[model samples]
Target: MDGVRFGEMQTSELVVSSRANARVKQLRAAFQGHARLSGGMVAIEGDHLLEEAWRSGMVLKTVFVSERRTVPGIVPRGVEVVRLTEEVFGSVVETQSPQGVAALMVPPVRVLADLFEGAGAALILIAAGVQDPGNLGTLVRSAEAFGANGVLTTPGTVSAWNQKALRASVGSLFRVPVVGVTASEVAELEGRGVRLIAAVGAEDSGVVAAREMDFTAVCAVMIGNEGSGLAAEWMEMCDARVTIPCPGPVESLNAAVAGSLLLYEASRQRAVSKVSGS
Candidate 1:
């Protein structure tokens, strides 16, 4: 295909119409998590997400735009832009309405120490086997909004890079540091002077209300799976367990809602303590 420049913007070089094309296959594989094993690349769709990825300084591998859509100017020079026919783009993406734009990006590399780099006291969120991608994505966004240092996902948790999770995060996934860890690794947070707080659904005799927790200090709040709640062993590792009080008929809050509430409370307390100089 011949390149067509838009004003001064760099142009696309190739138009892919075949589903069997190697680059098209790679995009699909990245979305399906196959590319992740070999190249650690994740496919992000929509123009907004692509812009967010660029603003966050992520390295873009390739950009794919449907034939009907113009290449976004935000795409940097020297990056390869592949224009795919509408049919091929539809086949490659998971969304009901393909956004006409997608890009493969390298997921950020983070270490455990990166979570605690500069903060005097850290507020961390842990996702323990959170199977729902939407919930996990919301938790990641909430973690950043509430000033959490970073998020840690246990081995069984849904990947923060999952396309559903990425889309649900509304680009906050690119802004926050999410690292995977083993259960044992999670237990080690306590060694660094970070208190472990488990978020449970209903009130228990031994558990404290979320408001009562001293969030101003370094703490990591652990949010569990949607269906089963936290594993008993994981809860046992926590310095304390806290629950949100609900007077209504519902048995529990959604995992993301519960986690976000806890994070907001933490943020509120920390802000108050900072203002009071206490």
Candidate 2:
């Protein structure tokens, strides 16, 4: 069990003892988000995320399993599987409590045009400068749950493939189209008839409340950074500024929470519009 190579391991596969092993090093780099080192593949831990990646038809490059655990049944034939010692596996993963299973997968490539392809009016969530990976991930999940056409992260927003964000998204990142674009690229959407809606704090006087806004139209809702909220640039670029009124007297809601509520409202309005038309 000690002298096994870090290549594909089966029933006869033994523990990979060397931290210097190529596969182990690759896994570490991927978890750290070194795009150059990871060959553009993203890392995901836990069986659930692994299974979700497989179910989502992600191009699984390799599955890394702890020597203490058997390779999961979800892994299809022909995909590379590497077995690592528990100690070495722990060192490579980000979680304090290593899940015994992890995998590297190629994230799906998408463009702004992809978001507008579907039949109905496009409902896109544009993350302007949201720094927190968890917040970005949650926004993607809500985007999917609320039937958004896609989620776009502009410059300064964390990457959707980030490890923490990927985990936080709970597999929705794989299903939802999360594309990265520049602020300039977003401005072009306005010309395409996609209205840009800015999410603002409740203190912004005269801004429409979430429930009252007309979200049935094609729109991109932009969530700003956690610390500074939306900058003047994005606010000015937006055709409308919408706020979520809070009776609790809080300054503002979390970025993810704000974005989720906005998406929910949009979803609700779309459903009502559909019913009315029918």
Candidate 3:
């Protein structure tokens, strides 16, 4: 199914009706973000994530289909598929209305080198300390949508695979590589000639307007938390500071919005540079 499926496929397998079933319990725990209980498998519901997971070639631990729903065509052969009763399935899924499908996929292990492997110049989005799951997810979405090479999350940021963030990203998580790093690791980027640009408030003095900033070079745009913006330490590490000029009367943009805007500006600049052979 292309979208959320409500009992769209018919399966002949027996339905798992017991909430106490071992696998069901594990699924529930996964939905609750218990990485230990779920053995580090990421739980994803809805048809869109299922399709994206398959498209991205993620390792599927199991695919749970609501009773009467058959395995989606998007699921590859030899993958374990289970059928769950409607009542039991709804209990485990975070969604008020379960799309009658869910899956547990192994989160890929990535190294710093993975982020720099592409032929194009590295354009990574850094989440310094953003706490909102949806915002983190949107940042991942924006990174991929704007042709960023990857997303790097600092120690204090929320998990990029949070349920709210996952749904908010609309399946971008499966396609993008998200790496969590420590403060010292982030500092090492500067040693590698990667310019760190701190996104600051509109009123910040000495900050370049995003459009005027050159994003063609290798750079990582850092987005801070919702309340305080970037810390002094992060700001100190940045080679430059950029602010999006908002003509309207607004104090600041949301963390995700500011990051997305910056990424879009970077993409625009990169596209121009590519076309003009600069």
Candidate 4:
């Protein structure tokens, strides 16, 4: 497909064969948080993610395709496309089976207000100190699937833009409004009249069962760290604490599973309420 034509679209001037090349170095840096901050872009590997980014209207700064692959027509006009030697491309990307395409994109800028743009009795998911990128990504995907208005991450939570998180999100990251916030900022949700619900282990006594809570109210469900559970300060801020009923002997649900279940319950409650009203 090397001869594939783009009518009048412009192509990159040089083929990058060396891993030491400046552009290659820049791509490598984009994989790291600090480096991404310096470059102001994130590296998304594989053809699927690149396409997802494009479909979501993410600004593509540059596209890198491996020597063995064809440039996908999905790439927008005027975007710089760099062809890299297979060996060099492998060296620059994290995925073992590189889809022969990747792109450096400007991470979407989002504010707390964006989460509530059209929200009425909004459902928001808050990841508080959840360190696993995969878990965080799954929660983000579930957030969108279950009709969440948006997702917010606390200071200690992994950035949803992390490469592993991005991949695990299965492109939902692009579609969901995810923004980071500090502990102080989280307090603002309460001021906005949104109920803060804390999710705890099923073993925890004296907590309301997940399904028993009224999720039809404007609410944000907070999922805490995998190991330590929610911080004391966070729990204190919650309007109510809830636990998913576990019939098995397992100590607790996985963070992602727990969060997803809570979201599903919320969606169910909201749907029922709407139907009953109608």
- Candidate 3 residue spans exceeding 4 A from truth: 1-12
Winner by lDDT between candidate 3 and candidate 2 = 2
lDDT for predicted candidate 4 compared with the true structure: 0.87
TM-score of 2: 0.96
Cα lDDT tens digits, model 1, 1-278, are 22323232334565677887766777899899885442668999998999999999999978889989998889899787788889999999999998899988888888889899894799999999899999999999999899999899998899888899998899998888899999889888888998999999878788999898888899999999899999998988999999999989999999999999999999999999998995
Give TM-scores for every candidate, taking all chains together and pairing residue i with residue i: 0.94, 0.96, 0.93, 0.94
Better of 1 and 3 by lDDT: 1
Scored by lDDT, model 2 comes in at: 0.89
Clashing pairs in 2: none
Give each model's clash number: 0, 0, 2, 0
What are the lDDT scores of the predictions, listed in order?
A: 0.88, 0.89, 0.87, 0.87
TM-score of 3: 0.93
Q: Ten consecutive residues with minimal summed lDDT in candidate 4? A: 1-10
Name the lDDT value of residue 87 in candidate 2.
88
lDDT-best of 2 and 4? 2
Ranking by TM-score: 2, 1, 4, 3
